[model samples]
Target: MTPVQPRTRLLFPLRRRATALAAVLLTACGDSSTGTGQPKSTLDQAVQAMGGAEALQAVTNEVVEASGSRQSPEQGSSISTPRHLSNFRYIRTDELDGDKLHIEHDHVTTYLSPERYQFTEVVNGASGFVDGKDTVFTPAQTSGMFTSRATAELGHTRLTSPLRVLRKALANPAIVQEEQDLEVDQHRFKVLVFREEGEPELRLLIDPETFLPAAARVLEDQPPLGDTVVEAWFSDYRDVSGVKYPYHLRITLDGVEAHAEDRERIMVNVSVPAQSYEVPASFQPPAQPVVPALADFGKRSTQLLQGLKYLTQTFFYFDQSGLPITLNELAPGVVHVVGPSHHSLLVEMKDYLVLVDTPLFYPERSEATLAAIKAKYPGKPIRYVIASHFHSDHIGGIRHFVADGGVTVLAGEPSVPFYQRAFSNPHTLVPDRLARNPVPVTVEGVKTLKVLDDGVHSVEAHRIQSIHSNDMVIVYLPKEKVLFVADLFNPNLFPSNQPAPYVWGVASGGLYDEIQRLGLDVERIAGGHGSGTGTMEVLRITGAR
Candidate 1:
């Protein structure tokens, strides 16, 4: 699976100063005078804050049990809810020079032990493999990736386990310190913030009376969300045979929260079996489809024009080979782009050709489409490329075609600044798209544009005031009575019976109203990412009164 980039938004001004203030505090703490002269010192304070060194060192086995609820909202205020349960185990090992640790967390065994090691995850049946180095044990399920490398500074001693959070703080005294109190659930806790430059602040809330941690909060390093925090609550401390355990751990990200239970039976000391850290012999990776190089780019091109086409008349589909390999081609010179994810269209113009959307980002697909266009239209040049929106998928390939001298057009409002910033500096993500061809971009207005140089191909770059995106545009061929649009309606079946109004609801239905309102006389519509080509009745199916 592709790694999702971290959603990091930093509020600049105050955050910059706060970062500097945190640095000064950490630097001051490094002074020998900063240490509390109580026989134990800061290192001992951390160990006592947890259970103790001997108690922590005695921990041989640990188990965690947890449960949580999840939900995803769909169109029309609909939602899907899923609940899950998990169990976790950790054991010390002499495998990697005795410092190695092995972790097996079941819900189906997601996270692994040892700081910088490879691990696999199976969460709610979704499986993924990760290979990276780390200082602390990593969780299998995460809300998002950390934008900075601050996690590398995290010591095992900072974690809530026997000798866990203390071990690192003892070795690095500047890592943890006490802070002001914060009240929650009518109880006050002494908040102590951990410092690691350039990283979000990690705050541990300790119960004032017991000095036991009540919760852990990591504030976003950036300002606006500087106070925006993710927290994990630890509770139900139980000590067995000198080893301490927190029976319950609840994590909250943004507003969502999940809880897990710790080991039912804690083992203080036992000989762990060998081969525990080894990858399971029965482990198997999920089967992934072989993607054709250029085909992925072709899929991306189709996704840009979704809100335009609705229930289909003659929709087109492509096979896996990415061959323009027709899944089902219904007519000549008109193609509906249909894939598993988005929508699109293919228009064979008089001389060169016009493509409606470019949704996916595949190096080979862009090349393949250009190659196919060349082969299909022997001497014609692909003079124009239309983008329906500014979404990454829709406009990802604009620079590719623009490099080829193809005049790229977008919805005037947002597209101007978008393309300007996007292509201001030469695009480097994928070079081949614009390698041999470099073209200028044209921003189309909220009106009609007709190109009669080669054929009667009209461009109706209208505004789609829809929830999908603001800068949405569509291409139209009045002479052919075919309109190319994206994200409007996805025709799963040719001549889809689903009403356009019901398909896109108020937003796209308003767009359908604009079609008739503008008097384009469209008869056939090709969608942005899915199968296109729709009859006049299909358009009327969602028309406004």
Candidate 2:
């Protein structure tokens, strides 16, 4: 197979203006006061600004009604243009005593097609439920017995509310300290740092004159962009029931806008219904075993590929754990590289190997898989790496393969520019192989279908339309009569007897329609995720539903 070079230059210079500006700001705002005097005084002033400590203590519950838009940076069709969920209406209710939160979210997303998603999430103490059903927590979230994924997310959400932050800090004064001041857009902000146990360090920026929280900043460890700064800016403060609340909130990830909201109503000490936090009687918990506690909390393990612990708090769907990598032979030349959560398939060609979907959230998994492939295959090199889609989990390790020297990436036509831009971005925070050894990457776009035939074996790459993503690609092996896909249908999750879940039914139905359109003989089906490969019968049963 001949590699197709990009029409334009692929390797562009990395942009460092933001990094330079941040460094200059940090230098200018060096710590001036170290003692507890500044922190205590600032806390007192902030409490007075927010209707005094009495008012804050009297608040037991809060209800906020807002409208906004949220961006899925990882699930975008392209790295540059993330999947945007606009026209979002949210009703969030919080019970401060038990650290309980219930949120109802309604939004519409348009990538290839317009689809509407409406769901309710609840977190009560140690248990979490979604739409009144028990939900599975990621390995990182279930690492500790005292804390769960839901509670961690609740804390992150509460950071946007200054009242909640002040209450928590006041309750534990030892954790609050005065940090260096910050200057942004000619405005200086007094920074109050909170170092809590088993939580990410939060830097709350306060307005010097108004003493209200101007913004909240925390460092989150995200793949492709490590140690990313997540900031939430607050504005338009309004007083309600003797308490001050911010009506406008804008959240940013690494200086890029992620979510923006404007409050329509705010209520304090509101009555919360019991059913909001209750799990349904028919709800069945996942059979997966509980994850063990880490040696150090909130720190990444150097020995293991387990992702950063705080990722669960930042990203709701983030889940990376240390699972043993196992290889299974599916066909005479096809091998399945299975990880704890995600999986990858390797197809042997005439001279080299073709890998389908580098499935994981980090390069470590890809690196490990590469080592395993080299060990098993001996001298064969990976010539082509096919990306199932532009989702972060599936493509996070693609850059690693590019750094391996002679691998051409195959992606959907719409995602070609996205891969180019993502490959050029500076990975200074945690330099991976690609960052350390810069190299030009060749990304070939598959408009509808692209076939690789080498007499002995042939692999076909086809772009399919799905509600899950616009840039969806599935691989077909006609000689073996096997189809490889991602996200569309996971047979293990949705068995042949069982019907596809709510939104998943739409995605699987689209896949079924595309299969019928192509008129290819498909016998076995493999997924980028899940445990085992399924049959065409399973796809028919689930997709037909």
Candidate 3:
């Protein structure tokens, strides 16, 4: 497809001048302001100034080819350095016609780890399909809590696009308002706000002098991240066939940069194939990817990887977001990392640090927790890691401790084998601290109960079998009178108004009985899945025998 040549005389009177003189020129239209006779609507002038509604309607297929560096931080898997981002090359192509659309994206990164990711989506009318070669994504996967999400979203996007969004706002004069008096990052702009009940509220900011679009903002809402402000800035305006288009684009989520790209060329109204938007007849929806179990780690299937990333996303909103670690002082030298939905304990002893139950989606959680502990405690080296159980979720990042130095890992019967397998599993896709820095996984298997004390502080790993698993272990701190348990005493899953399920993972009175049988002083009860509460309070409320 050939780009439309710009009307040199009318559109380029100012000729995209040098830096200083460029500030005085207007790129969009003839000129209109308060001093002008009839105040031409900013949006109308903007639409016409950029080659009008017809130029936009002419675009059936578009290809944007650019070369720039993309940030790739294998987020939750790193230990020593979390902020490291590798550069990558990428290409994106999009096609649209009536109610059909197709999108293809390819990205390859060669850095601390070498990998390739490709994603393609096609939507024809009400049908849609998405597939990609992602190491963390498995085949036959469906997205949604209880329904399909990709199909619904892609189908809607097919009928609506940036041009369509702009057209809809212009078609409804009542929803469009010429507004101004808005300030963002200390820069004031004249804006046209478009408000529709069911559609997104969009605000288009224009340069006061040129009346050209400077930025656009959309208000999007969700449950987890709440109402988010998505904004994009347009810069380096260039004439592609008589039409003015932005060469540089930057999109930000909340306030963090999500994408930054420099467009080398954009070809519109290109030839598109019929199969581009057609969904195959033999498509079978795969269930949503979930964080995998320990066994899934070695398989390196897409399902397991998607699950791993999704699990981490469930706790931390975005991969680039900072670690959310809030330390609750359980007692002197004993701290509970309460920020993660999946918690961890940082125990400081006279000679070393003992972290019990490194939980959450992946290595990033453990790495963050380890950093927080060392930052606060400073010189104490972590010598022992008390892995409470074998459940993969309870100890996803146990290897971070091992990678730090010579750390002895303790798990109960049956779980130690899992520890060995997890420690030695293949991690070529998403390598972690232990994977990058080879270290011997020192782990101890406890049969019934095990105890370790260095005169100042003490910890005991007890194998307390429950309906949840035959090899569960509970951690106990004697001097602090605080007892830590995993699935056996998770208060978060407690039934409201109903009896303790006493079924499967939901614990029973056996935990209470065990506490009494051991004659352990347990005033405060901490957990791997629930809020730490008083031992008597949990027993009284849950009626734990």
Model 2 lDDT per residue over 1-545, tens place: 23333232211122311111232122222232236533336666677788888999899889999997766566664555655645577798987766678877675544323445465666665445454211222221222122234544465565687887788887889989876566655677777888878656788888877888889877654554344566789999999999999999988666667778899999999877787776443332333222223212122211011111111212323344444788888899988788777788899888999999876655557788888889988888888888888876777777677676787888888887667755666655356777787776778899999898898789999998887778899999998998899988886875568657655567777788899899989988888766688876677677764
TM-score per prediction, in order, is 0.47, 0.66, 0.45
Span of 10 residues, lowest total lDDT, candidate 2: 302-311
lDDT of 3 by residue, 132-213 (tens): 6433224434222211223233322322234444565556678878653455665666677877653445777776665567
lDDT against true structure, model 3: 0.55
Of 1 and 3, the candidate ranking higher by lDDT: 3
365 Cα displacement, candidate 1 (Å):
3.4
Task: Give the Cα error of residue 269 in candidate 1, in Å.
Answer: 14
The stretch of ten residues in a row with the least summed lDDT in candidate 3 is: 4-13
Q: Residue 324 of model 2: what lDDT?
A: 70
Model 2, TM vs. native: 0.66
* Better candidate number, 1 or 2, judged by lDDT: 2
Query: Tell me, what's the RMSD of every candidate?
Result: 13.2, 8.1, 19.6
